[model samples]
Target: MDGLFTYNPAMVKAALGTHMVTGYAEDTFITIEEISQGTTSKTGCDGETVRSVDPNTRFSVKLTLQMGSPTHKYLLNRYNRDKKDGNGSFPILINDLTGKEKFSAINAWVTKLPTNTKGKEGQNKEWTLETGQADFQIE
Candidate 1:
C-alpha cells in the first residue's frame, strides 16, 4: 500500500452534554489539551535520583464556534445557569470517525464565558472546559 493519508473535518465529531457541536469556527475549531500532572523525577543530595509518578489526569478542551451559532448560544445558556447556581457539570466527548482517536471527560464544567470582540466582521467565540480527569487517546 502507498503511504497516503486523508483527513476530513466533517468526520470529526464533538459533543457537549446532549448537544453535538457542528457549527465550528473557520479554523482550529476544537482543541484538546492535557494538563501536566507534576514532576515525575527529582535529584537527591548525592548523585542519586528519585522518581515519582502522578496518576492524576487533567484536561482542557477548547471549542471555537462561529458567532451566533446554536452551539454558542447553548454554551452561553449553560454558562449563565452555572454562574447563577453551582450545578452545571456535563460530560464531553470528541471522536474522529476517520480513525481510532477519541477524547472524553466524564465530569467537566465550563471554565468561563468566551471573550466578546466586535468589529466590522464577527469574531469567533472560544469556550474552555476543564476536567479533573479525562481519557485521551490518539492513533
Candidate 2:
C-alpha cells in the first residue's frame, strides 16, 4: 500500500529509556544492534523464489549499570506489512533485563499500534507509554 511509515531507532531508544520497568535511564547508554531479516522461503511447487509477506527486523540492545546489579538486555522486533490495511498496525516487542545476562527473556513485552496520530505541521508527534508491564529486576 501507499502510506507513510517511519521507524526512528532514536525514538525507540528514547521509549526504552523512559521505561522505568528497565530500571535504567537514557544515560545508561544502551547499545542497539540489528540482527537479521527475511532470509528463508516457504516450500514451493516450482523453483521460483517466494518473497516473505512480512519481512522481519530484529534488534539487540545492552544496558550496563554502575551498580553491582546484573546488566540489562533487550530485544526488539519490527515486521513489515504484507498487505495494506487501514486498520493494520505495527508490532513492537520488548525483553526485560535480568541478572548479568546479555539478553532478556523472549516475549517479555509486546504491543501494536493500529494507527499513528498526526501533529501540527512542524511539531513532532508524542508517543504515549500506556501499555505493557513495568518492573525492575536488575536492581
Candidate 3:
C-alpha cells in the first residue's frame, strides 16, 4: 500500500437515463453504463475578450454512444421513424445508473449525428448525439 509508487485509480461513473424522443415511447431508456465522457459546449470553446462576450448565448451538450447497444438502436429507430416529421426539442435526463431522480434537462434535441464511418472495412461507427437546452440541472 505504498501511495507514492502506485498509479491513481480511475473515477468511474455510469450514465443511464431516459429522454423523450418523438413521443414514440414516453421515457425511452438509455441503458448503457460504460461511459467515458459527458461533455458540453465548453469542450471546445475559447474565452471571449471582455468587450465582445455575449452572455445570452446558450451552451449545448454532446453525448456519444457506441454502436449496437439497445440505447443506440432505440435512438436510431426514432431517428429513422420521425426524422422526416420535422425536428423538435424534448426533455432529457442523463442520470445515474438508477435512471431516476438525477440530472435533468428541458427543451433539448439532438442536433447532429455525424457519420464518420471510415476505415477500409467501415470501422469507427460510434455516434455523436448533440443536443441543446435552455435549462439543466444535476442533483
Candidate 4:
C-alpha cells in the first residue's frame, strides 16, 4: 500500500506548471513559460485582468498524506524565497473538497527532482485525477 501511493513525476510536473499561475481562483488560467526545480513562469489572471507572475516566484513539489493512510497526494507550491534562503515558508491549502474532510494529522513535505519547461501557448492546461479512496480521505 505504501508503494501504491507513488506519483507519476511527469504528471506532477505538468499539473504544477499548469496550476502555477491560475491557482484555485475561479475562471483563472496560467500560461506557463518554464518549470524547473525552483523556478517557473506564467501569465496569471485575476478575473478578466491578466498579468505576469514570473521569475520572482519559486515552486517546490511536495507530497501529502494522512497519518495512518498509505496514500499520498502530490502538491506544487510557490514561494518567494529559495530553499536555502531560509526566509519564507507557505502552506499549500487543500482544495475545497479535501478541506471539508478535516482529516487528522495530514502532513506535507517536499518532493524530489522538480522539472522545468519553456512557455508554449495553448499548451497550458489543468489535469486532475480521481483517486480510488473515498472523497473525504487523503488520496
Measured by TM-score, the strongest candidate is: 1
* Root-mean-square deviation of every model: 1.6, 18.8, 10.7, 19.8
Q: By lDDT, highest first, what's the ranking?
A: 1, 3, 2, 4
* Alpha-carbon lDDT, every model: 0.85, 0.32, 0.39, 0.27
lDDT of 4 by residue, 1-139 (tens): 5644443222221122223212221232212221323333445475454444443222322232222221212232222232446432233332323223211112223333224323542222232221111112334
Q: What TM-score would you give candidate 1 relative to the actual structure? A: 0.90
**Candidate 4 TM-score to native:** 0.24
- Per-residue lDDT over 2-100 for candidate 1, one digit per residue giving the tens place of the 0 to 100 score: 977788888999888898887789899988887875558878789798877777788888999888789877777777888989777788889988876
Instruction: Write candidate 2's Cα lDDT for 21-58 as tens digits.
Output: 23333353444444445365676778777766434344
Model 3 C-alpha lDDT per residue in residues 1-139, reported as the tens digit of each score: 6645332112112232353222111222232221223332342246643333333324444444433335555555545544777544455555443322244445444455647565554232333343433333333
Model 4 spans with C-alpha error above 4 angstroms: 1-80, 97-99, 102-114, 125-139
Against the true structure, what is each candidate's TM-score? Answer: 0.90, 0.24, 0.42, 0.24
Clashes of 2: 0
Q: How big is the positional error of residue 133 in model 3, measured in Å on the Cα after superposition? A: 3.4
Better of 1 and 4 by lDDT: 1
Model 3: how far residue 108 lies from native, Å? 2.4
